[model samples]
Target: MAPHLADWRGRYVGSALAVVKPADTRQVAAVVRACAAANVPMVPQGGNTGLCGGATPLPDGRSVVINLSRMNRIRSVDAANNALIAEAGCTLAAVQQAADAENRLFPLSLASEGSCLVGGNLSTNAGGVQVLRYGNMRDLVLGVEVVLPDGRIWDGLRALRKDNTGYDLKQLFIGAEGTLGIVTAAVLKLFPRPRARATAWLAVPHPAVAVELLGFLRARCGERVTAFEIVGRAALELVLRHIPGARSPLAGDHGWCVLLELTDTLDAQALDAMLESAIAAALDTGLVTDTAIAASVAQAAALWALRENISEAQKIEGVSIKHDISVPVSRIPEFLERAHAELTAMWPGVRIVAFGHIGDGNLHYNLSKPDALDNAAFVSRTAEVNRVVHDLVASLQGSISAEHGLGQLKRDENARYKSDLELELMRAVKSAFDPRGLMNPGKVL
Candidate 1:
C-alpha cells in the first residue's frame, strides 16, 4: 500500500490489504500460496488500464492486489523459430519493439499499447485494428506459463506452430481474465514484418457499401487487405472536433468513411500503385464515393490516428454507454439499420456513435445524450440500453461480448446468452483447474 490503492477511470476504487510486487514467477507462486493459506482472495492487476473493471478489485478489503508491473522481462527471442517469449508484465509496445529488433512482427496492438501489459492483453484476448489480419490475442499466442490458484506452476510454454496435443490448456487461461490463474509469461507467434504498406481513406455511401467494399478488396488483394475499418459520420465528427488539429482525411463527410490498409511482403511502390488502381476501380463501380491515399508514412499514420483516437475523443466528450458487440459480416448492415431505428425511436436526442473493425463485423456502438444528464441518471439507464442492444445482437446470432471478455461487466449477461450445458462445462473446467476458487473471483464465470 505504499504507492496507493488503484483507481482507474474513476470507476473502480478498491483498497488492498497490501499491494505485492513480485519480481518473478517463483515470487508470484509464493505470494499465491501465502494468500491461499490465509484463505484471502488475490486480485491480479496489470497496467490498470482495462475498461471492463477486470483489473480493479472490490472495495471490501478482503484481498491483496498482486501487481505484475515489476516482472517485465524479455525471456527469449527465437528469430529462427519465429517466436518470442516475454514475461507477463512487459508492456505491449516493448514486446512489439523486441519483435521488430528480430525483424519480425507482433501484431496485437491497441491505443493503450504504450501502457497495457502483455498479460492483460492476453487475459482479455484483445482485438484491435489489426485483428482482421492477425486475429485476436488468443491466436497470436502460441503458449503460456501460468501459476494456478493453488500455487502450482503449469509450464506449457512451447513455441511450436503446429502442436495438436490434447486439450490446448493455454486457451483456458488466455481469455480467462485471470479467473483461472495468473499468466506469468507467454510464448507468442511472430510474423515476417510486412516490407511495405498502402493505406487509403475511402468514403462509402452506406454501411452496406462498406461491407461490399470489404468483400471486394479481400477478393482482389486477398490477405493483403491487412485492415478495413469503418467510421460513421458522427464518430468522425467527434474526433475532428475534440481531438486537436485532427483534419478530415477526405474532403467532405459522406454517410460513412472506411480506412483501408494494405500491407505486403513485396515492393512498396507496386503495393501503392496496386491500391491506387483498386480504389479507382472501386470508385468507377460506385463502391466508393471518394478517396484519399496517404502519400507518405506520416500521412498513413495520421489517417490511422483518426480511427484510433475515436475512443479517446468519446471519453473526453463524456461518460457514454458503450457496447462491444459483433455480428456476422453478412448481417452487419441489417444489425446496424435495425439497432439504429429501434433505439432512435425509443430514445430521442440520443447520439449514437457507431464504428469499429467492420472487417471483423465488430462495432463499438456507444450512446450519449445531446442534452447532458447527471451521471447517476445516465448509469441507471444502462440496463435498459443493454437489453435493447444485446437483444438485437442475440437476434442476429452475434456475440454480446466480442473481443472484450465478460469481466464482471457482462458476466451475468453472458450467462444468460450461453446455454446451460455450455455453462456447466465451463464450470466443470474451472473446478477441475481451480477447485478452491482462490484465483481471481467474480470474473468470467
Candidate 2:
C-alpha cells in the first residue's frame, strides 16, 4: 500500500483501506463489485509513474486501491492488422518489445517506458518524443476493455481499421484518468519497424528558429521527421551536473538545443542523405548554428540521454514547481519570450528549466528553486506563478495540461482555464458513465 498510495514524484501521498492486485479482467471486475456493493470508493492505479496525483488515492483512507500489476499479459498480436492486445499492467517497454518481436514499432517512447504501464499511458493520453509523427496514446489505441464503475465489464476490443458504428465509446476511457472506468486491456496500433534512423543534436538561435527548421525539414523530408524536441540551456546544465556521464552533444553554451530524429521503414542510406541535405541547407540559411549527427546507435542513445534524464536530474537537484504546458506551434516562440520576461520580472533569479516535444507544441516548463530560497517558500508562490503562466497560455489559446491529464496537480487550474459550459458538458459525460463516482474518485472530473 505504501507504494500504491503515492505518486512517482512524491508530490502526492495518500492512504487506502487496502491495496488489491487483480490477476485478470474477471478478478478486477470481482474486486470492483465488492467495493461497489459496500459503496466504497475505488482508486484504479497502474505503474504509479504518474506525475499528477490521478493514481494516488485520497488521504481519507476510506477507498480501496485496485493495483493492476499482476495482470501483465500481451493477449494477442495481429501482425497483419498492425495491432496487438495487451493487458493494462504490461509495462510500456514490454509492449514496445513485444511489438518489436513482431517486426513492428510501438512509437510511444518515454523516459519511464521501462516502468510505466500501458494502461496509465492510455489514461493520460501520453505524448512522447515521436508524437509529431506517430500521434499520442489516444491515436495509437484502437479499442479498450474497461471495467465500469459498477463492476460491469465493457469489452470493446476491436482490431478493425474502420469502426463507424455509433459512438466511439472507447475514447471516453482513454484519457479519462480512470475516473469513468478502469482500462484493463487495449488494442494498440503499431507501425512498420523503421529500417533507417537519423538522430541529431542542433544548436538553434531560438525556439522560433527551431520551429522554422521543423517546417523546412518537413517540406524536404516529409513524414520522416519523427521527433523534434527542445532543450533549454538550464535544463541541459542540470542534466550535466546531476546525471552521470551526461555531456553536451554540441560545443559551447547553447541557448536552446534541438534533438531531431528522422525514421523511415525502407532504406537507411536514403534517409541519412535526406537528413544530411536538410541539415546542410538549414546551416547555410543560419537556421541551425551547430550540429552533431549520431554516427552509431550507441551515439544516438547517448544524445537522447541528455534530453531524457532532465526530470531525474531536476529531482536530484531539489524540489521545483513543474508545469506540462502546450501552445500552438506558431506561438511557441512568443510564449517562451513572454513567459521568461514575465516570470523573471516577478521573481528575480528564478532558475527556469524548460524542455519537451516542441514539434507537437508541448513543453515541460519547470522552475527550480533559487539557491537563496527554501523549497517551502518557493512552493508557496506556486499559485501566483501559475496565474501568470496559465493566464498567458489562455490568451494564446494554449493548454495548461497538454499530455499529462488533469490529475489533482492541475484539477483547479483546468477548471480555471476551461469555460463553464465546457466543464458542464464534461461533467455530464462523467455523470453518464460514472454516476456513482466510485471509480478513481477525486480525479479529472
Candidate 3:
C-alpha cells in the first residue's frame, strides 16, 4: 500500500482506502463495478513511474487504487501483422523483449522502460527518445481494451492498420490520464529490427546549430535519423559529478552536446560510413564543433547512458523546479534564450539544466536550487517559476506538459492555459465517459 501510494520522484504522496491487484481484465472490471456501486472513487495505476503523479491515489484516503502489476502478460504476438497484444501490467521492457524474440522491434525506448508499464504509457500517451522516428504511444497503439467506468468491458482490440470505423473511441482514453476510464490492455505496433546503428556525441556552438545539424543529417541520411537529443553543459556536468564512472565522451569543455543516433537496415559498415560522412560535412561547415562517434555497440550504449542517466543524477543532486515543455522545433533556441533571461532576472543563482529531444521540440528545463537557498524556500517559489516558464510556453504555442500527463500537478495550470471552449469540450467528454465522476477524480479536468 505504501509503495503504491507514492510517485517515483517522491513529489507526490497519497493514501488509498485499499489497493487492489486484479489478475485479468475481468477482475479489473469487477473492481470497477464494486467501486462504482458504492459511489467511491477509483484510481487506476500501473508501474507508478509517472513523473506527473498520474497513477498515485488521492490523499483523501477514500479511493480504491486498482494496481495492475499482477496482470502482467503478453497475451499474443502477430508477427505477420506487426502487432502484439499486451496486458496493461506488462513492463515496457518485457514487451520490447517480446518483440525482439520475434525478430521485430517495438520502438518506444524510454529511460524508465524497465519499470514503466505499457498501460501507463498509453494512459499518458508517452513520448520517448525515438518519437522523432517512431512517434509516440498514440501513434504506436492500434487498439485498446478498456474497462469503462460502469464496470463493463469495452473490447476494441482490433489490430487493423486502417479502420475507417466511425469514432476512434480508444483515443478518448489515451492521454486522458485515467479520468475517463481504465485502459486494461493495448495492441501495440511493431517494426522491422534495424541491423545497424551509429551513435555519436557531438559538441555544438549553440542550440540553433544543433538544430541545423539535425536538418543536415536528415538530408544526408533521410529517415535513418532516429534520435537527436541536446544536453546543456550544466546537465552533462551533473551527470558526470553525480554518476560514478560517467566520463565525458569528448575531451574539450562544451556548452552544448548532442546525443545523436542513426539506425538503418543497411549493413554495419555502410551505416557507419553514412554517419561519418554526414558528420564530416557538418564539421567542414562549422555546424559541429567536435564529435565523438561511437566505434562499437558497447561504445554507443555508453554514450546513451550519459543521456539516460541525467534524471537519476539530478534526483541525487536535490529538488528542483522541473518543467517538461515543448516549443516548435525552430523556436527552441529563442525559447531557451528567453526562458533563461526571464528566470535569471526573477531569481539570481538559479541553475538551469535544460535538455531533451530537440528534434521533437521537447525540453526538460529544470531550475535547480541555488547553493545558498533552502529547499523549502526554493520549493515555495514553484508557482512563480511555473508562471515564468509556462507563460513562455504559451507564447510560443508550446505545451507545458509534453510527455508527462497532467495529473494533480498541472490540472489547474491546464485550465488556466486552455480556452474555455476547449476545457468545456474536455469536461463534456469526461462526463460522457465517467458521468458519476468515479474515475480518478481531480485529474485532467
Candidate 4:
C-alpha cells in the first residue's frame, strides 16, 4: 500500500484504503462491482511509473488502489494482422519482446519501458523518441478493452484498420488517465522490423540550426529519419559530470547538439553510406559544427544513452523545476528564446537544461537552482516560474503538458490555459462516461 501511494518522482505521496491485485479480468470485474456497490472509489494503476501521480491514490484513504501487476500476460499475437493483444499489467518491454519474437516491431519506446506498463502508456497517450516517425501510443493502438465503472466489460478490441463507426468510444479512455474507466487490455499495431540503423551525435550551431538539419534530412532521406533529439550544452555537461563513463562524442563543445537516428529495412552498408553522405553535405553547408557517426552497435547505444540519461542525471544533480512542453516545430526556437530570456530575468543564473524530441516540437525544459539559492527557496518559487513559462506556451499556441498527461500535477495549471468552453466540453465528456465519478477521482479533469 505504501509503495502504491507514491509517484515515481516522489513529488506526491498519498494513501489508500487497500491495495487490490486482481489475477484476471473476471476478478477485476468482481472487485470493481464490490467497490461500486459500496460506493468506494477506485484508482486503477499499472506499473506505478507515471511521473504525473496519475496512478497514486488520494490521501483520504477512501479509494482502493487496484494494482494490475498480477494480470501480466501476452494474450495473443497475429503476425499476419501485424497486431498483438497485451494485458494491462504487461510490461512495455514484454510487449516489445513479443513483437520481436514475431519478427515485428512495437515502436512505443521510452526510458521507462523497462518498468512502465502498456496500459499506462495507452492511458497517457505516451510519446517517445520514435514519435517523430511512429506517432504516439494513441496512433499505435488499434483497439482497447476497458472495464466500465459499473464493472461491465466493453469488448471493443477490434483490429480493423478501417472502422468508420459512428463514435470511437475507445478514444475517450485512451488519454483520460483513468478518469473515464479502467483500460484492461489493448490491441497494439506493429510494423516491419528495421534491419539497419544509423545513429549520430552531432554538434549544431543552435536550436534553429537543429530544426534546419531536421528539415534537410527529412527532405533527402524521407521517413528513414526516425528520431531527431536536441540536447543543450548545459544538459550534456550535467550528464557527463554525473553519469559514470559518459563521454563527449564530439571533439569540441558547441551551443547545441542533436542525437539523430535513421532506420530502414535496406542493407546496412547502403544505409550507412547514405547517412555518411548526408552528414558530409551538412558539414559542407556549415549546418553542423562537428559530428560522430556510431562505428558499432555499442557506440550507437552509447550515444542514445546520453540522451536517455538526462532525467536521471538531473535528479542526481538537485531539485529543480521541470516542464514538458511543445509548440509548433517552426516556433520552437522562438519559444526557447523567449522562455530563456524571461526565466533568466526572473531568476538570474538559473541553469536551463532543455532537451527532447525536437523533431516533434517537444522539449523537456528544466531549470536548475542557482548556486547561491537553497533548495527550499528555489522550490518555493514553482508557481511563479510556472506562470512565466505556461503563459508563454499559451501565447505561442503551445501545450504545457505535451507528452505527459495532466494528472494532479498540471490539472489546475492546464485549466488556466484552456478556454471556458473547452473545459466545459471536457467536463461534459467526463460526466458522460463516469456519471458517478467513481473512476480515479481527482485526476485529469
Superposing all C-alpha atoms, what RMSD in Å does each candidate have to the true structure?
A: 1.5, 0.9, 0.9, 1.0
Per-model lDDT: 0.88, 0.92, 0.93, 0.91
TM-score for candidate 4, please give it: 0.99
- Worst 10-residue lDDT window, candidate 4: 368-377
Candidates' TM-scores?
0.97, 0.99, 0.99, 0.99
How many clashes in candidate 2? 0
Query: Candidate 2: RMSD over Cα atoms?
Result: 0.9
lDDT over C-alpha atoms for residue 314 of model 4: 87
The number of the candidate with the highest lDDT is: 3
lDDT of 1: 0.88
How much is the lDDT of residue 244 in candidate 3? 88
Stretches of model 3 off by over 4 angstroms after superposition: 372-375
Compared with the true structure, model 2 gives a TM-score of: 0.99
* Sliding window of 10 residues with minimal summed lDDT for model 2: 367-376
**Over the stretch 44-71, how does candidate 3's per-residue lDDT look in tens digits?**
9999999988888878998999999998
lDDT of 4 by residue, 65-96 (tens): 99898889999999999999999999999999
Local accuracy of candidate 1 as per-residue lDDT tens digits, 135-180: 9998999999999998989998999888886888898888888888
- Find the number of clashing residue pairs for candidate 4: 0
Indicate whether candidate 1 or candidate 2 has the larger TM-score: 2
Give residue 164's lDDT in candidate 3 (0 to 100): 98
Q: Give the higher-lDDT candidate: 2 or 4.
A: 2
